[model samples]
Target: MNNTKDFAKSSWIALVLIVLLNSCGSAVKSTPPPLRSQAEVVSVGQDKVEDSVEKKLENVKIGDAQAYYYYQLAVLSLASGNIEEAVDSFYNAIKLDDKSPFLHTELGKALARKGDLSKAKEACEKALGLDPSYLPARTLLAAVYSGLNEKEEAIKEYEKIIELNPREVQPYILLASLYKERKEYDKALGVLNRWIGRHQNSEVGFYHMGQIYLEMKDYEQAARSFEKAIEENGDFIQGYSALGALYENQKQYQKAAETYERALKVLGDDPRVLDRLLRIYTQLKDYNKALAYAEKLKDMSPEDEEIDVDIGVIYYESKQYGEAEKLFRGYLDEHPENIEVRAYLAATLEENQKYDEALKEWEKVLEQDPKSFDTRIRIGMLLSEQGKHDQAIKMFEKTLELFPDRIRSYILLGASYNQAKRYEEGLQVLQKGLAVNEKDPALLATLNFHIGVSLERLGRFEEALTTFKKVVELDDKHSNAHNYIGYMLAEKGIRLDEALVEIQKALELEPDNGAYIDSLGWVYYQKGMIDEAIRELERAVSLIDDDPVIHEHLGDAYTKKGLFQKAVSAYEKSMKLKPENEEQVQKKLEEARVKLKSQITTHTTGR
Candidate 1:
């Protein structure tokens, strides 16, 4: 709803009535009896004045001139912000000329301004009764109802006004705006469509239609309407901006860029448009264009230091790590307290493999906020990556001390211990994590999987199997659990068919996974399907050529199939690839060589 004070201040109808009364020489008599003081006038409120003013007004002779005199006084009172006097004057005018709808409507407007909506609505209804077709009275009534927040009543008044005068464009716009405010998109569209049908050239109507369609999530129709609105008026900056925003929402970066560029042509050097163009170019990874716009934005908004960070990020995303590091370091040198820039600088340093420098920056962040859990985790992970397992474990333990319920701390600490071959310590850490987060399914599954790995490494086969089964039960689609259980069973020489089924399930989930393929091949070998074993092992070797275990498995399969020469070649390759079972593989290689030599000698002598 429009501000009642602004509406009343801009009331053209009141101005016209004042002008008409003045032209007819119907001014209120200056020497009239002192009716009421300003305090008495205000005290009357919206109630009927039973003061001296009403008694004097009742005694006045009834005529058009007399009614105009009272109407002139009301208009002046309304202009002076004396709502009580205005209401009394308008009521006096209505008593003299009860047939004048304009007087009744004016009375309603004054009462509405005085915070008397009920009486105001009653006065508007009386005006409509006096002259049903009076557009001014109907419009005033609509505004009054809208002010009262009686949306349905206001809509009825607006619709009635539109029915009475279909050619008037204002009513349609007002009604559509009202519906739009109420979130009645269909009704708003209905009103706008009617207006557009009558005034096909109205750019504003088309723009409003586009807004309604956009609100309804009908992107196609909204784009069409926005396009049409622009076609009707090429200088429509708002239409171009809206179209750009719609394209951005749809992820059409190139089109959004073009639309925002068009907006720039119409509104040159606009910072908002430039910012949008920069963002779009950044998303498209067109760094050159993005940098250009970012520079322009920086120049336009020189006080916004965040733009410097944006430029540094663009450099980082473009893989120009040296440039990003330089920029962030320079920015930090001037503003050392900027934690965000310092973090970005640390990331840049880490990306450039300057681990020591990155660690220093992260430590500084800890100084600023010692409770920064994620940063501490990053420090731990970096330490772990650099082979400082002891330091990494200490950092993760410290993180757990600060936040005992942090699941990631437990997971990372367990991983560190496992990486250092401390299986018992890893098991303990994971068990602690499980105890804390037992009810959380995802965390439970992860902890159980890790526990199973630790148990397997510690040679607790039965416990490991039970833990793997628990993982599978927790989440049936855990491919790793199935593969681990299958490989473990096959290695133990038990449950061969069950192992094959589990390995096959794992392979089904990840058809192209080299690890799963290797497990399948190993299971096939355990089941005595030598041809199937060789075929699968060859495929696994082809998929993951560098895995030493796959090479060893292929060598074993070859030896089992009586291909002694091929077995020697496979075993030698496994040894070359740094097999963990170096002694065992050497024994296998010597045996294969001896078998080949013996078979050759026997075949030659017998022949």
Candidate 2:
């Protein structure tokens, strides 16, 4: 229902009345003997007193000028928003003129403002009792009912108000809101539509309708409504923002970008608009644009850790790893507790080959939050890559403690155990994983492959061959399985022809994979095709220069071909690459040297 301007004005008066009443309770026992004038009762404005007496009260008969002054003062005070003073002046005015129900309604609103709901209700009822058609009293009654949360009664009062003044807009708005609060969405829309038909030019009406559409997930209608609102009022900031959000939700990134740009024009220096643009640009893969908007947002809120993180991500995604690292460090300095930043920084460092540094960062994250199973797994994987197999196993085991179902951790930990030559532990771990998740293709394949690796390392070639066959049968497309089993078979001298087929299939799947290429080369070497083996091994070494195992394979191929000096050189290079194999390489080197010296001595003696 419509709250008249006077009702709002009267509420302020009610606050003053409460303050004055509380202040006076200990000071004055009764209403002070009637003031000589309303001006004497309170600080009345000069123009107001003069205007009230000269204009509104001149037609009414009062017992004395003080009565006239108080009567006019009450109406003047109510009009002026001095509601408490209005109530007091109204009481005095009634003392002079008691027949006016309109004045009682004013008094009721003041009472309502003071939270005297009971008295306010009585006063409003009395005003209606005195004048059955008193619209102001009825409207005040609705407000009182609303304050008491008597929603049905409030609605009834508002309906009465609408009936009395069919052309008014406020009662329609309130009724619509009431229906919306009750989740009667269709009814709410109906009310709003009817209201919009009458108030078509109201941007507020359009905005409200747009919000309703948004709630219903009617993006098209919502966008249309928001656009209409914007067109009606070009400076409408919320309309533009709402429209932009609608487009974003629809994945119409370009439209969303344009809408946000318009919103930025209307709301200069708004952080929210900048953030929306940043997100949109990221989705569009327009990293440069995303960074620009991110910088703008940072300029406004320099300490916003989320925006800084976004800027870092843009850099990282665009392959500007160095810039990304700097920003990530800057963000970490400010928001050291942010796990996401720590994780991203770790990932970025890992991508840049700073594996040890990344491991340390992930460790810190785990230290802060031991429940971070994902980070623990990443650290374990990094450690394994760096050949810290035992440490990597520990990290993976800790991760398994937190998340027993993460089968990837089992695979990684098992692989690390094999790398450390703890074949028994590796088999047990893969077996445990397989027992739990039999249908998991990746896990099953990995289990079979690792079992084969461990059995072969233990010199159980027959058992290893059986396990490798199981791995290929379970997943023919498992390229590594093909490579390893084929390489193992060729090495064991039991099925050289069959091994060639498996390794060739593996090479077909991943031709450029250096390890797979090396496997093919080693299989050829086992088959005694010295020239072909050398060609394949040389290609593998060229593809991956850092792998000591590949260099060792090259040395073995050369030795098999009777190239003593070349074999020694290849063995020394392998040892230099990985001193962890120094003892084996030195023995091989000494044997090659002795063989070369004996051949030289025999040639000299024969000459």
Candidate 3:
């Protein structure tokens, strides 16, 4: 059975202001004044000038002095970080001068800072209604809409800001971000392009463009944009990080490592940069370099115990299993109650071939937390490995009881039964697993494969064939399923040609598989290609010398070629290897001996 684990993994701009006023008035005394001479006209003109000055003073007094005072107070409060006071002052200012969009916009900002987004939005909308082209109001409204999750409204406000001031880069950036959040990649790119076109030297714009391209899965353009971002501003740490990630995603480990190394040189041992370097080095299998960076990370964040586990895993992956074991063991010595650390230690012990020690560690883990399904599964696997099938079965059963939906437990239980040669029990367990998760393709494929093995072992040839076919239908890449069907057909002496095709396909998938090679040889023998059969069977035996079945097949091929002496030698080897087939192999050996004696006698008589 396949032990498949499914791991589910805004800108603003200022504009010029122009005020125009028109006044028209007529007085009855104006006709009398027109009759006056130059001197009289001069006197009247002086009076008229004084009257105009008095009217200007009255207009100034009529202006909202209280509103201007409150607006100034709001600005001062905002600058002093008194958001509540700022909001109150701005509200008072707006009440005095309700037509002032700027005052309204300021109120919106203060309200937004105070976390009253709905009121903030209302104030911003009021500002926009008074002066739709007011950049500050539009900017505030966009941000308010974004805070309220009204993305389309936010986009509209941002667009208006851009229209008011195309040179403003913040709006473009904010709009692009909103587009990206909405998954409108093309629109996001369009906005970023506008920003880049306007400000060619903007490293931030290039970096944002790179992010957008990365989200769209345009890796080439993303890489190019990131490169440009770093080129424009070599000190851009985020640019380096993003570029390294892109390389890593494409499996370009060398480039990723180099990018992170460069970042470290510029960034000077930043923990995040060091971690990336460690991961990249690990992927490249440069364990020495990986360990160096990992050490740096540990030093940088010594209190993070997870870093210790990461270091241990790196050591294990690098084949320094003993070192890995010692590291985890050291951690467990201090944190004995840490189940995760203990589990890693157990795995390290298992990898080092200390199965008994590993089993003790797993038991300790279970003692701490009995509901750890992963630990229980590991213990069961260890027991099965030690040939304690009954104990393993109990553990697996207990796991199923605790987590009825854990498909892995069912697979392990069925597989343990298969290993124990309890074919019936294996079949029943796998069928039950299938019933639990009928639609999970991996589980279905695994259960069917095991069921096929059990049915074949129970001498139910037709059922076994059907099961194997079902397995293939579920997972055509199941190489073992292909080999089993081919070998079964060859053994039954039917469909030899089809069997050859199937086995060849299996061999193509796993060219070095001895079982598949043996199946191919058996198919050839059934097809009466004695020489080909002998060649393939010999190769199969060379690949897997301990398999008595391959030896038996080889002997049969030799017997078919009338090479009785070779046949006798092959049969003798098969019998020595597996005495359970002695009865049949002995009869074959006797026939080969008799045939050899008859041939020798016939040759002697003819001479």
- By lDDT, who's the top model here? 1
Clashing pairs for model 2 are: 13-82, 13-83, 13-84
Per-residue CA lDDT of candidate 3, range 373-485, in tens?
88899999999989999999999889888988867777888888888889899889878887674577766888889889999999999999999999889888889998999
Scored against the true structure, residue 224 in model 1 reaches a CA lDDT of: 93
TM-score of each: 0.65, 0.57, 0.73
Per-residue lDDT for 365 in model 2? Answer: 86
lDDT of 2 by residue, 492-544 (tens): 76588888898889988888988888888888888788899999999998899
Off by over 4 Å in 3: 1-108, 121-142, 148-168, 178-191, 215-217, 249-255, 284-289, 295-306, 367-369, 372-374, 403-409, 526-530, 555-578, 583-607
lDDT of 1 by residue, 254-285 (tens): 99999989888888979888889888999999
TM-score of model 1 (CA atoms): 0.65
Candidate 3 clashing pairs? 10-170, 10-171, 11-170, 11-171
List the candidate 1 regions with Cα displacement exceeding 4 Å. 1-148, 156-174, 181-183, 214-220, 250-271, 284-305, 401-406, 428-444, 466-479, 494-521, 524-607
Model 2: weakest 10-residue lDDT segment is 23-32
Per-candidate Cα lDDT values, in order, are 0.81, 0.75, 0.79
Candidate 1, residue 109: how far the Cα is off, in Å = 12
Give the Å error, residue 246, model 1. 3.8
Best by TM-score: 3
Cα RMSD (angstroms) for every candidate in the order listed:
11.6, 12.5, 16.0
